[model samples]
Target: MSDKYAVPNKLPAKQVNVMTHRKRRLREEESHHRVKRLNRSFKLRSKKRDYKKPEFFITQYLKAERDSKRMRRVIMKNNFLKGVDDEEPKLLVVMHHRAHRVASKECTLIMNSMGLNRLHNTVLLKNTTESLALLKMIEPYVVYGYPTIQTVRDLIFKHGFLRIKGKRTAINSNKLIEEHLGEHGCICIEDIVHDLFTVSDNFKNVRSLLLPFSLKAPRDGWSKKIGVSYSRGGEYGNRKHEINALIERCL
Candidate 1:
């Protein structure tokens, strides 16, 4: 048994680089084992410390505290910087169709690239020149506009999710947010909300981390069909702030 467990003799040191590669592989194997041990210890300690509580309670508490601090900061900032630094505009684009006769394949590809592949799929976009150009290309198949703070919050709380390891996971606890986005200064749900509502510098990263919101069809359905301008009482094009009313019904 002892002989079976012994480390194998090193290969004949042919090519100094091969020896270096072998050493690197061994180091990686050791590090992997170390990490496994640490995780095991952590789980054991957790079980010993609080058998009754769920494993994620600490993550939830930390997340709640972080969110509270962020909210307080927002309140204080709003009070002091009411008009000093107005937030940049953001666009809430909703897809009502996949392909349209008026839309080219390139336009549909742009929409799909933006994660709006299904009917009633919604995404928040920064109002930059590039985004505006893309929206122009797909304007005939979607509705978009400036969303109010309440609308942003409601959407996150009700339909918001984080994409982790390419899986759509619910925002049920702060631990999830921290695990996925803590490095980006978003440790809680409120951090993402603030970043999006204010269109902060981290908005792009936060938006990409979030899964597209799958909204229900607008409560009475579209009054006007797609492939026309919203000004003409059509469903496509900008609804401005009026988009809020449409999103509310879907919510």
Candidate 2:
């Protein structure tokens, strides 16, 4: 938390490098696995720990695949819009998690090239926070971050998920509403999914999480600051750089 991110006051970097840290972690994990396998094969290890396929691990892998499908779907719908042949296509942005500025800008630039506009249509958010993961902050999203139904179940059942930034996020709603809801059973069916189709390229499940989406837009100044004007200066500058780079690459 101490080491904050400052966007270096220049044209923003691209998203291609956002996962560098995560990729390093993955490589480390792979190395560890290889060493473990070698030890088991050679005489260096005494106890032969049999590779038991745990159902929990299986569940997590499935969850990641599911989330990825959902993500791609969200991306296609919001960003690479399907219906319009003539008009500018809307871009869908699937933020797997809290992406850094460079990643966000690169994603926006990519969508624009695919005939979609970042200022409209794209949606970026953490899928697991509120429902899919249904647990705590999901620190594993980076390296230790492993997504699974079992891990989520543990978070909800073991930890009651009472604090803010848990598996899900509650927007600027009344605290009294939360307290009262906590005291009693309630039902809030966010109906937008049914009304409007949302495909998740990551998860592949199109849940109706519309109320928050609708509510969040106006609150996020969507109604007022839309079109090209809504693009923030820093993000826009980065988008410009990314676009030029993309064009140069194509050439």
Candidate closest to the true structure, highest TM-score: 1
Please give, for residues 1-251, the per-residue lDDT of candidate 2 as tens digits: 34367445554456546567779989999999999899877864676667756985676566656545655565555432323333321222221122222122334454333223322222222322232221111111211122233322222222221223333443334352334342332121121121122222411221222111110121222222121211352212113123222222211
User: After best superposition, candidate 2 residue 216: deviation in angstroms?
Assistant: 28
Which of the numbered candidates is closest to the native, going by highest lDDT?
1
Model 1: how far residue 21 lies from native, Å: 88
Clashes of each: 0, 33
TM-score of each: 0.61, 0.16
After superposing candidate 2, which stretches have Cα over 4 Å from the reference?
Answer: 1-151, 158-160, 163-179, 182-251
Residue runs of model 1 more than 4 Å from their true location after superposition: 1-88, 97-103
33, model 2: CA deviation in Å? 41
Per-residue lDDT tens digits for candidate 1, residues 3-73, read: 98987686565777797999999999999999999999999877755345675566556654654564455
Worst 10 residues of 1 by lDDT: 77-86
What is the Cα root-mean-square deviation between model 1 and the actual structure?
23.6
RMSD of each: 23.6, 29.7
